[model samples]
Target: MIAQRKDDHVQLAVEQQQQHSGRNQFDDVSFVHHALAGIDRPDVRLATSFAGLSWQAPLYINAMTGGSEKTGIINRDLGIAARETGVPIASGSMSAYFKDPDCADTFSVLRKENPDGFVLANVNATASVDRARRAVDLIRADALQIHVNTVQETVMPEGDRSFSSWVPQIEKIAAGVDVPVIVKEVGFGLSRETVRLLESLGVRAADLGGRGGTDFARIENGRRPLGDYAFLHGWGQSTAACLLDAQDAPIPVLASGGVRHPLDVARALALGASGVGVSGTFLRTLLDDGVAALIARISTWLDQLAALLTLLGARTPADLSRCDLLINGELRDFCADRGIDPRPFARRSGGLDVPHEMTGSTR
Candidate 1:
């Protein structure tokens, strides 16, 4: 039990780094401000549909916790916010709750609080199909999010190192559950090749929990003596880069990791993401100002998204995904090395607002 508490502290502390880590990798993405965007603000739609369920906004409260009684409060607060805003709320890994039946209520609280809103249940990629079904039943979740954290396992003291066998297990769970299945990278970003495999196996959506956010490597290093692993703290691909690589993927993607304000969210949407998951920011807000403050912060984030959409002349979240953006600096070089043409962006001094219609939607 003490070890669990330690794990919780380490997770919370590392997640707090999101407050300082600036998510802006590209210095040149800007929308052409439509001064004549005569559309009424209230008429703007921020609604989005993911895995067949419609959400009020594209901001989903990603998985957090369900191990102990204390976690109940955090889950409850986030669930309340989801219920109020009509967004989806995801519960943390249910493995711990499955091990200790007494802690079941810790996760069940999410469904209790948000009966009408969409709730997503989570489990490690290594869980068996039966366990995955139990986790879904525990949260009354609308979907299942299978999280893969390979590096985190390598650094974590008790983390499982043998996750290769979990692929078939994932297939079993995906086949058994009627709900949509989403495979997610815990912190390290997902590669295009890996995405292609999951698509072949019938996975519906993917979330790129990329680098530049609460690094699990740094967190694990903090809990133990640091050396080679410590040097690997900033090793993964940036969220922006990963987004570009996975933009043309077979399934829709959710841009996570290092996302802070609404501008970050808007930029992600413009980069071809169907939605943005706000986790660390919500965790910090809950810790500092309580549940009400978290809700207020989310409300502000949603409003900012609406304003950004208006500025970009996007009428809907789908439209935002099609909006054009400019790439520059190291990002431009990286894309060029991969045979992508950066000439259009280099010709422009700043970012140019390319209409999604003119550029043609990747979808």
Candidate 2:
């Protein structure tokens, strides 16, 4: 069963290679470019830290596939990319490993390849305290991501039905696990109320797995008789909308879902995300081109992001907070309805000064 699940995930990813609902809502976001940019290319910094660890890049490889030998190779190559780029990598749900201990190596290969690099283990929200601990142990993770895919599951023909125990189950896992716990969505973005609930349960961080990326619902629906779950195709909030809702969240927000471009990453950082996650794009890249090409692509992305930072007049990723950002179109409407002030984000660094002073010469 777990093997089939892995196969199904990979198959769906391939089949939907060119399929994106554009529901991630990134269209409504536009960055205010300051051509009076003073930052030099060398001065552009892309460093980001989370859970007490630092990485050369701000983006991490979000979860994708596991539990099968084919996926095991995928994890190996991803681990190599993480090690090469100094970015963290997360495994797909370890439920498969828990169900079949023999499959542990597939997930464990992440730790094997990137022993010193930051690694994250993932599991379902419905996981038991014991299962959570073991999942963490399975990969020697620095942190654990308990994925909450209530909607994703509802669409799957063989998905779980009972969700009443989610909160309690998550609370137990958060309290029991030795590592910091991060609650995540599978592609359907998370909201402020959900963030508040997770915070109440002691979760320190969340991945606002917003829409505008992969369509798991569509993937699951495809597995069915085509028209079974068609009515719910456009479900969930866009990644931009989800990020806006997370502004008031006490813990750090890690934006994921439909984050495909460096501009999207920049937009997410400006809104409220401490860091961003990219999965399908990276995975698809690796699949299309070998690991070396994938590594080169990540390097190009970082360079592009740094160059963008130079243009934004922000020295570092954190400095983007003080940079001018605009949320228009549907995203603005979302903030208006939610009572979130979009004006504050449109500042010369949110009124906070950048740590480094710029030279007098304007670029």
Candidate 3:
């Protein structure tokens, strides 16, 4: 049953990607072009540090699939891409392995294929400390991502209804696990309050798995008899909005969900994301094309990211924070209502003077 469910998830995710349309909040963000930007492409760097480890690139292949033969093949191909591209890869929720130990090899394939590369083991927030450790040992993971998906659970036909233990359980897992713990959202974005809660728990990082990517609510609803919960399809903040919410967070903020191309990756970095994760888009490429094509695409993204940084007058991923940005459309409204000052983002370089009302003060 678990294996079949995993397979369903993979198939549904692919179908969703193929038919997905409309612009995400990333569209509301625009970079202030620097015509006199003197930085050269060769001098621009993509290397970044997040989740207590150094990454060759600012982006990684986020958690996707495992636990079934079909999903295992997908994992193998993704692992190969990561190995060739020198980017991190994460396994889908290992809850299936805990349910059926026989499925261990499915998740283990990630380590088998990319022995020396950075691998992240994923588990739900409800996992006990012992289960969390086993997940890490299963993949020899350098880091662990404990995903919180209240919305997904609510919409999933067979999902858990209890949520009282999530925070306490996550705190225990974060403290007991040897590897760095990154609290992640599945598809819903993390809010500033939630980010603060993770920081208070002493977690090393947070992955703002914001909306605008694969819609798990829609997927879970598709499994239902009536296909209800369509109204909840647009639930939660976007990756770009979550990045704005996470400004100056004590822990490193990683962005994912709704990231389409290399420019979106650059936009996330400029919005203060230490790292970015691409799952649905990358998975679509691999399934539609082949592993070789995915590898070439990732390589192309790296090159494009360098050129973007040079064009923005930033020398490195961290330096992107200093580049100016202009927030408009619904995203600007979100900032105003959320008490976030969007002007700071637009005046990052301190080249333009903000108006009295546009000063750094939040509502």
Q: Which predicted model would earn the best TM-score? A: 3
Q: What TM-scores do the predictions have?
A: 0.89, 0.93, 0.95
* Candidate 2 lDDT, 1-363, residue by residue in tens: 779878888888766766764445787777776556556788887888665656677888999888999999999999999999888889998889878988888899999999998899999988889998888887899999999988779998889999999999899889998899999998888889999999889897999998777778887887787548987776899888998888768778899988888888888887778788998888889988899998998878788888778888777888777777778888899899999888877765544334454445555
Error of 1 at 123 (Å): 0.6
lDDT of 3 by residue, 181-230 (tens): 99889888999999999998878999999999999999888888999888
Q: Between candidates 1 and 3, which one is better according to lDDT?
A: 3
Ranking by lDDT: 3, 2, 1
Write one digit per residue (lDDT tens) for candidate 1, span 179-288: 88998886688877777877776788888888766777777666665445787676676677777777578888888887868888887887778888877778888877
Clashing pairs in 1: none
Range of the 10 consecutive residues with the lowest summed lDDT in candidate 3: 351-360
Clash pairs for candidate 3:
none
Better of 1 and 2 by lDDT: 2
| Model 2 alpha-carbon drift over 4 Å, by segment | 21-24, 348-363
In terms of lDDT, the poorest run of 10 residues in model 2 is 350-359
Over 4 Å off in model 1, which ranges? 2-15, 18-23, 26-28, 32-38, 225-228, 342-363
Q: Clash pairs of candidate 2?
A: 23-212, 24-211, 24-212, 322-349, 322-350, 323-349
- lDDT, residue 7, model 2: 84
